[model samples]
Target chain A: MDKVTEEELIGRSIKGDRRAQKSIYDALSPKMFSLCLRYTGDRAVAEDILQDGFITLFGRLDSYAGKGSFEGWARKIFVNTALMYLRKTDALKLSGDIEDARSLDNGEPPPGQQIGYKELLKMITSLEPSSRTVFNMHVIEGYSHKEIADSLGITEATSRSKLQRARLKLQDMIRKRN
Target chain B: MEDFENRFDLEVRSLMENAEEDVPSRIWDGVSSALDRKKAPVPAAVWWKRAAFAVAAAAAAAAAVFLVPRSTPDNTPTPGAPMVRTEVPVTAAPALLSEAVPSRPIIVAAAPAPAPAVVAAETAPQEMPSPETTETTVTKKDTKDQGQTAKVPLSFNKALFNKESRPKDIGRISISAGGNLQSNGSPAKMLTGFRYARAKAPAKAGITEVSESTYGMTLSAGIGVRYNFNPKWSIGTGVTYSLLSRSFTATYYDTSSPDLSVTGKTDNFQHYIGIPLNVYYNVISRNAIKFYVWGGGSVEKGVANKFILHDSSRDIRLTERIPGVQWSAGGGLGVEFAVAPNFGIYLDPGWRYYFNCAQPNSIRTQQPFTMNFEIGIRAGF
Candidate 1:
């Protein structure tokens, strides 16, 4: 027998072929989830987003423009699903003026003061969704200040200021414990 | 492009990638179930059949309520309440088509339906007994009424026997006090029923005045069910495990003894697992408790053995004795009483044989063969 091709699999999936869809999920869910974590800032949060995004993919597989890369398209879908969850839970309520957000001088804290990747997750999960999202996009996702603002429907300056404030609070928390 | 930014992104992603977090078990089940839903699409025909069955059941139950007389008085306070308007009849139809056919009649109701009579009796006045009790009374009455059904046993043998004759699925299993029956003399109407008369056998039956006794009666259980068969006849077979046993003790006179002593002593025993097959004639099936009896072959071949046991000062010694093949061939008369046209009980006096000798006519050299009896209440589908 011949090996199955990717394009054929995707086409079959669009036509309600469940096996094709499962094959696709199996092949791509882990990589797509890796990208999702950069945006959602937490593993559990990222998985929730991944599930919702896959549901959308199966429901609307017919709308693929076939122009942009499939990975890029799926990445966007995952980001949107995460944001949708945030929106439903009222977790993203950005209220401060743009001036309140500012870049801190201590952007590069001492190695020991800066929480390790694993420690940071515990702190991130504890943050309000607004703090987590800003911390995720601006610091973790490598999104520029302007991009974070545009994506979250907040001003670029506000995005920067929230990031600074979030970091400040986390630093205080780290200090009070040690 | 910022140095700190790229490192923060890396750290965040690493944290998120940690493999230690446990996923809930249901997540896998939910995902798999969702995937499975897309693969096997249920056919509309199956749904339609189920719906049709439901509708037909509802209609018939409504009709039974319109019919079947309520025997108990109106002004009675009842105890224990059963569901009143269920579609299940007291008996089940035979030859379980949807389910694998069981050897013993599987009281037909898969999931039981409430009998209108049981329900009527249940809510009659709170003074009336529960459907459970009503069901029990129905079974008890059925057990006692096997004689009436014989009047129409031949005419409505199949429908009346398997379909109409047997009771609904006995929900719970029960055991009863173990009983014994001992007798002598060969049955004239044994294998094929009471048809031919014996040539020189005693006229007043056999085994002059043997006693039917009970001991260790332990369990009692039952269930509620409804019954019906469509298009044609329903036949069923059942294996009865009654823990039934019997022993014989009598005078043993040995002229060969040195003193020609008459040592009044005896030794006899039998343990059997019986199977009954019922054939029904369905002319008046829906309500008639009439059918022919063509069963009593123990579900499988059996061996009836005896032991000459001697009581010693310290322990009793056992000497094994085997019987012949003709004795193991057991079948007999069955009479049923259909209470709800669908449910009832039966009394089977099956012919079970065991001789002192294992070989045919081998016992002729030793002595005459000793016979055993088994009579009990039978429930069918």
Candidate 2:
């Protein structure tokens, strides 16, 4: 959609026009679903998060002042909704010792270039829940360790440790697949 | 090793940057159903127009009632008859003698001797005549014995001498208390659509669950003053205080862990102070009873609004002061029973419609239209 049409759609959606809301949802839901899936491995849980994100988006749509990209603004809501779900489920409670991540490194060369996108996503989802969350926040979303820690209510060191463990686990899986 | 780590992170980020997965169609259906259950926003202008229309209609109706001519007994003397003072005897008729035995001077229209007498003016009667006796019969001898007045039967219309007179411009101060006859349920459910949305959640997922809602009794009390412009029409204004409350419990079950659930209970209380202006039309008036129909509008401001939420984790209490005024208009029937000459008690059973305002969730906002009953004592001067 053109910028003008997108702005109009947003205006109408804020006013509770159902067609406008559906249009926005159709445009945003796919990417948002993928984001939810990356944060929550289960398809059913991701679907629940997706529904809640859209609801929160429409509820707080009035706060969007067109200062930033509308897509970015909407993405934040979906991310927050996923995070809220994680917190409520206590999915971010890290287990095991941080030193355990170093043992899995194995000094192996990266096999990322040979892996397909689907295989890579599968490997990422296969990581433990807390580690996967930390990895997604720090690597894919460009959040700093401190930001991830603050968001997940964990220490910065713990966020870094989870990310390292997640990366080692993913590399190990990728090497086995190759 | 560091280069390998950098390459792995870069590859993962690039692959996931534009990742898009097809969303199941049922998620949109759930969202659509949830939006449908949400309360539609009411523009402030529309409610203002409605309230203005109500107040205007009420004023116009009251004006129409006041403008119509009232039927009163014609007490003016016959057009051409000259008024004369004379003494009339009450001895011939026993009823007249018992009523007015002592002859007193009265003004009567002069006519030929022995002609029927026309009473122009007489002393105010102590007792009112019976309805059946429209005209009092005075024998000719009653006047003949005096010889000073015409020897005509003293005839008069009893209604002209009615002892009980209709009061005008009566003022009344009243104190009233009443409650809503119907329950408005929980305002949180009405405002947030939380329960409805949770109900529409996928059954297999079993993502959301809510408990039954409990609502507190809605109550109101006020002190008012009314001024009767005439015997039939009057206007009233008063300050009223209202209290509304509701509570509900909600429990959400996690899809991944069915055994784990979060439960929360919410309680809401709202207090409003209102000023109402009403117009009343008396439909019936008998010995000491009156029936009236009234219509008017009111503007209320929320003085205090509080929401309390209790969950397994923590308790949250929030107080929000809504800035905008709440508008409402309605009409109902009322009856007043006079306990004394100047003191009466009244009952007003009426239906009221509350207009949506900027105020947060409350019973008034949840159920805009409600039936209320009010009882109070009124002192008239």
Candidate 3:
């Protein structure tokens, strides 16, 4: 089988070539699925968001400029799709952690216990949807607090408070596990 | 604190950066099917067809009003004054004439050259007597032949006055109670937030069928005053208390928890107190049955509402104070049996479409149209 280049595949898909569209889906679906799952925390919802993201991407395929990585552009679409699903369900509303703020500023790691990648992912899932998104974008995805606030349609103070609460909650969970 | 934060960030990135889950093969099929549906957009032809149907329905209703035989009189009835016209043949028996005219039917003027003398008879009396008494005592003797003009005080001719009316000749009031079944137009699309993945059932199996959605019954009770303007036309106004209720099962997937869904059997109840203004025309008046058509509008205030969601977790109850007032315009046909001259049993079947939305933000808000069918007894003076 001949290997089709990304540009040629995009051009073919734009022309309604089913084979090329399938090729694009095969190459990109796994990574996008992971991103959706992180945001949704449920397999069915994640899959739904993934399919919706792809539908939107294909519909607006003509709008994509060749200025950035195609994968980066696709990732942005999946993130937005997940956010919309959360908003419709009111999952992005802030939790009551602000009023229940207890000190969780432990300076040192728990003795003789190390957090594994699976445990870390579990911790992220346990946070509220709004707090989880803030934590992911600011701490892992390299978005500034201003950028997070702007994207989520919340104030910078709200974004900051959510992230602080997420960190405290994660630390409390880790200390208890240790 | 900085060291701890860096360690936590590193763990998150390492777990999330290259994480991948298997893409379900069925998803491709779903996507392709959705794409196919989008490609074939529903045309505007269906809309045009619906409009044509609605216009035809409206035209039929209008034709019915004009074609039906009308026997209602032309004068509005005054509470203390009896002024009505009867359309009985001059050669009719005096006893039959007395049976037809419950109020004092008198000839006010002589017949013109081209027209027969029109006798005005107020059918409803101030305080109506029993059918046996009314039949036995009413006489067709001319009021003027007795040397008493139309100005002869009702007190002087008390027995001549229809007993259905009060002694002073005030008109009559009728009260009724009935039940109705209403459709809310269409069910709203479900907004299930999330659903846990489950094993797929066989394609032909009907395991996923939800419960049947059904229309609900509403109850109404009212008291009204009917004033006969003429033999063929009458106008009425009344206050009614209506209790409207609808129950349905709504299924929603829980967003906060994975693999959790709830089926809510919700019962919504609303109370409205309304004043209705209506005009009725007598189409057929036989020995004991009177068939008429009435069209009216009601101004209603929502007094209270209750929403109960019974689910697997726990029942949630909400009491809402309905905001704003609503009004509806509707008409229907009615048949009344004169069990007695002043007491009758009536069956009224009508359609009432609300002019404004009721109970906004609630399930009761949709389908502002209702089909009302009521059967009750009427007592009038």
Please tell me which predicted candidate would have the highest DockQ against the true structure: 2
- TM-score computed on alpha carbons, candidate 2: 0.56
- TM for every model, in the order presented, reads 0.33, 0.56, 0.43
Tens digit per residue, CA lDDT, model 2, A54-106? 87677667656787688877776677677767766877676866663563435
lDDT: worst 10-residue window of model 2 chain B: B195-204
For candidate 1, lDDT tens digit of each residue in B151-265?
Answer: 0001122232234322432332222122323222223322222111111110111111011111111111222121234322334444443221222211121223211111111
Who is ahead in lDDT, 2 or 3?
A: 2
Q: Name the weakest run of 10 consecutive residues (lDDT summed) in model 1 chain B.
A: B200-209
lDDT of 1 by residue, A108-132 (tens): 5423235565565566657766877
Per-model C-alpha RMSD:
33.4, 15.2, 15.9
Tell me how candidate 1 scores on lDDT: 0.40
Q: Rank the candidates by DockQ, best first.
A: 2, 3, 1
Docking class of 1: incorrect
Winning candidate number (lDDT): 2
Q: Quick one: how many clashes does candidate 1 have?
A: 33
Chain A, model 2: TM: 0.90
